[model samples]
Target chain A: MKLFFGEIYDDHAILNEEESHHFAKVLRGQEGDVVHVTDGKGKLAKVEINSISKKVVEGSIIELKTDFEKKNYYLHVAIAPTKTMERLEFFLEKATEIGIDEITFLQTFHSERKNIKIERIEKIIQAATKQSLKAYLPKVNDLTKFNDFIKQDFENFTKCIAHCEDDIVKTPLKSILENEPNKILILIGPEGDFSRDEILNAEKENYKGISLGQQRFRTETAALQAVFAIDWELKS
Target chain B: MKLFFGEIYDDHAILNEEESHHFAKVLRGQEGDVVHVTDGKGKLAKVEINSISKKVVEGSIIELKTDFEKKNYYLHVAIAPTKTMERLEFFLEKATEIGIDEITFLQTFHSERKNIKIERIEKIIQAATKQSLKAYLPKVNDLTKFNDFIKQDFENFTKCIAHCEDDIVKTPLKSILENEPNKILILIGPEGDFSRDEILNAEKENYKGISLGQQRFRTETAALQAVFAIDWELKS
Candidate 1:
């Protein structure tokens, strides 16, 4: 099935700029071509191309479905960006492919996404979503400071902070899966890990320190591990 | 501590040609510099560089450690290579970081690694092993035909074949972890997936059909997913 990201409306849908160009030029799409479109909000529309132009491809929605391939849980990962943007982009791509609901860049003491280009990052996530045939696109937020971000109320989610600090008692993620928590939000720190005070502050807010495994994964790998942990445990 | 991949012996270690070049040139190593070298076969040596040259950096083994951070389980993944070599390299790098023991490229009817350069593939895995501070370097096998590959004895390991064939009553990987099998061998097909006869032959050899998850993962993603499933389950 040919799937593209687009905006869905009452009875018609228009492919996004890139998708429109791809359909019109790259794929040489024309009228009467049938394709699937996703709104990136858990809605899938089967459409028949009615109007095709160089800049816009509009289609009549033959069928619309909501909650397409919806998982039973929500995963929000707030991770400290890597020194290299490629590593963080890898995390975004894999997390989107594996299934994640939201992602936030944590501006920690050691690392920050200072030069992050949000548009390019969004494109990477969108590509992964389309490649993985996902209807719901994972949300990507701006670079948020650690202190300011931790103050948000996560009263209903399993809030975890993965750090490399040895003194702190860390719990394994599998232990938390014992109760099968549906809503999970994990904060993976930079290579230097969350500052002593940063971890302490999160601890005061009920965020548990979690260890991914024995191996020392890179910052991106740590974040993806958290994503796989939930999606793997809950699904199976 | 700087860790590198090399050959270890009784009282001395010699960095591989590339790593020796990296040490002598990239990192600018001199005599008396302390570093750690791994044989990539479960031995690590604390070496003090006593002899240094352009292409050979030999060091005296100050201390040696065997089975350093050795994982409890062994993972052997026989996967059909992807069309793009980058995807297969990505799998090799990630699998090495997460603790895979052996990897074999299955020359399946759908996809084959005809142009796969084994040396470059080994380099990627070696870099990952060093980056992750792992002692045991994963063994990379030559591309083997699917029929010839399945005939090899896998009597003790929990052998699984992940395919897109829905006719087979597939078991989730998580289900197989109930008994916590220490050794696991999973066959991940190419993007087109394994043929009916290929899967049936594996089944004839007691290879249970397993599903990684619900997502339509790419060939590389499926292989990495299997690696994570075992590493994640066994670790925690």
Candidate 2:
């Protein structure tokens, strides 16, 4: 069954513009057709299409399913965006498919790209979620300054920073994930990597230095590896 | 220090056309310059540029270092080529970066692509190997049929196949990697997945069914995940 995204209002659900186009034009969905829809908030509903339009598609809920897939842990990865948007988009798509809770673009001292279009990233996230048949939609937060992000209190979250600085004896991410903390916050730097002061500041803020692997990975690859490592550790 | 690929012949080394172009034109390497060269066969040498040309560059070995990173275990992933070449190229590049010993393109029942250009893929592997500064260059074999591949004798090797068959209760890859076999061979099916008979035939041939993760991953994603999983298991 193909999955669509929409919002549930009362007994009806309305798909947005893109979803509407996909349903009405691409899929050739007609009135009275049955479709599966998700609200991106862990709600899945079987609905009968009542109206099909270019802008919006309305449907009446036939059955509602609240028991969608739920993640066992919370994974928040804050990464410095790559110079090219494709790499970051690829990371976002793969991370969504592999199960990530949240993603934040960080503006660090060595970051090449400081600004990111959240709207574009959100679209990729939604598409990946639907493609993977996932109920929970991961949030894409706007770009935040590294200093400001570190200042925010994570409280009980297990914080770690991924850098390539040789001066610091970084713990392997696999070892860190061995403990399997319920909430994980990992910071991945850009191509140039985080500066010494940035690493020190993060360490001061309780972010432990962690290394992804022996080979130096690109920004996007490191981010994806972090997500995969976390997910692997949690499940295993 | 910049890294170049060349064959150390006696007391001298010769760079290939692509490497020569990169050395002479891209980097503007001049004579009498010192550069790090790798033979891609677990050998790294410090060489002095004796001659520079667009077609081929010659260097004399000044010092030799053989202490290259070696994997304790062997990983050979045989996967069906994706419909698009880019995804397969991406997988090759990433697998090289993440440390893979061998890659084979398989022609399965549901495989969208049957033929792959070995030369193009080889270039990607060499570039990724240089980018990661690794001494080991992975081997890319020509495309082979799934049936033929399964029939081959993988003596003393832990052979596994990744298929999305509904009837079979696939073992998680993590569990299979727990034993830490010295040699591993994993086969990843294409987009439409392997035919039921293919899975059964493999099972009959001692190929264990392994699941990468819970989510449905694309061909390239599954390949990369398998490589990453194997590397992680061996390293940890």
Candidate 3:
């Protein structure tokens, strides 16, 4: 099913500008034609086009569904951006395809890349979401400082930090979610890994230190590995 | 520890041309400098630099180790190449980081890509191996016809195929490997997926049909999913 990103309202929906152009100009869509639309917020609809233009495709919602293909669990992956933006972007695209609820770029002690182009990241996520035919879009937040991020409240979430410190005995992520908690938050470290203080601070906040197996992975690879692991845990 | 890709011998080792340039010119190595080298065939060594040049870095193996950090299981993922080359390259890099033994490209009935640049792919695998400090590199084979690929001898391997056909009651990949089969070969379909006739042919060959999950993934994503699943199975 080809899903176009757009906004869904009570009785009608509007395709986003880029999607509108594709529907109107690329696909040569016409009035009265039915198309599948998703608002990337668990809302999907089959709309009949009432008007079509290059940058505006207005349609009346012939059928609307709320909580469309809802996810049973929520996964939030907070990762430190890689030294190279391409790797992080690739991770975002694949994670979206694999299924992610939310993402955050953590500015850690050893994070090399400080600033990221959120607009570009968003476009990549949207493309992957449409390509994978997933209705819900993964939410992305601004880069948050590690200290500030840990200060936030995560009362009900199963918070886990994936670190490579050899001194601590870490449990595998797969084993931690045996009972299948609905809300999961995973923290992935940077290339040099989180500082000793960062790990201790997280532990002080009651964050469980988890492991992503023995072999070491790059910053982006670790994040995606965690994301894929969560999906495997929930799906299986 | 930073790992460099090279060929290890009984008493000495030689870095590949690209790696030699990196070590001699980029890193400015001198005589007596010790470095770690992996032959990508389960051989690793600590070498003391005896000679250094732009394209030739020869060293004496001070400490050689075979089967260094060896994996417990062997995973072979055969997937159809994606239409876009970038997607396939990204998958190769990530799969190497996640740990894979071998890979093959299948020219299926609906294959979008018929040929690939092996030199480029080899370079990617080498870089990922070095970056991940892996002693063994994932062997990549040339594109082969689907029928020819399925006809190959896979007697000792637990062979499985992943497909999205609704009619087939597919077993989850995780479930099939519960017994911890050491050698595993998984087949992933193209963007258009495997043709019905192709699926039937594989089934006739005693290939167990498998599913990655309910969600649909692109050609490259599906292949990486299978790779990750195998790694997860072995490491956990």
Chain A TM-score of model 1 versus the true structure?
Answer: 0.94
Candidate ranking under DockQ, highest first, comes to: 3, 1, 2
lDDT tens digits, residue span B1-236, model 2: 78888897778888877889999998889999998899898888889999986699999999887848888888899999999898788788888888899888899999878788999899899888988888889988899999999999989899999988878979999889889898999999999999999999999999999888887799889988988887877864
Angstrom error of the Cα, residue A13, model 1: value is 2.7
Please report the candidate that would top TM-score against the real structure: 2
Per-candidate TM vs. native?
Answer: 0.94, 0.95, 0.94
Chain A: TM-score in each model: 0.94, 0.92, 0.93
Considering every candidate listed, which one attains the maximal DockQ? 3
Give model 3's TM-score versus the native structure.
Answer: 0.94
TM-score of 1: 0.94
* Candidate 2 local Cα displacement, residue A160, angstroms: 0.9
What is each predicted model's overall lDDT from 0 to 1?
Answer: 0.88, 0.88, 0.87
Name the weakest run of 10 consecutive residues (lDDT summed) in model 3 chain A: A227-236
Clashes of each: 0, 0, 0
- Look at candidate 3 and tell me the lDDT of residue B45: 96
Off by over 4 Å in 3: A53-55, B16-22, B53-56
Output the better candidate (1/3) by DockQ: 3
Mind giving the per-residue lDDT tens digits that candidate 3 earns over B61-132?
Answer: 999889988888888999898999998999999999888899998999999788999889999998888877
Fnat of each candidate: 0.70, 0.45, 0.75
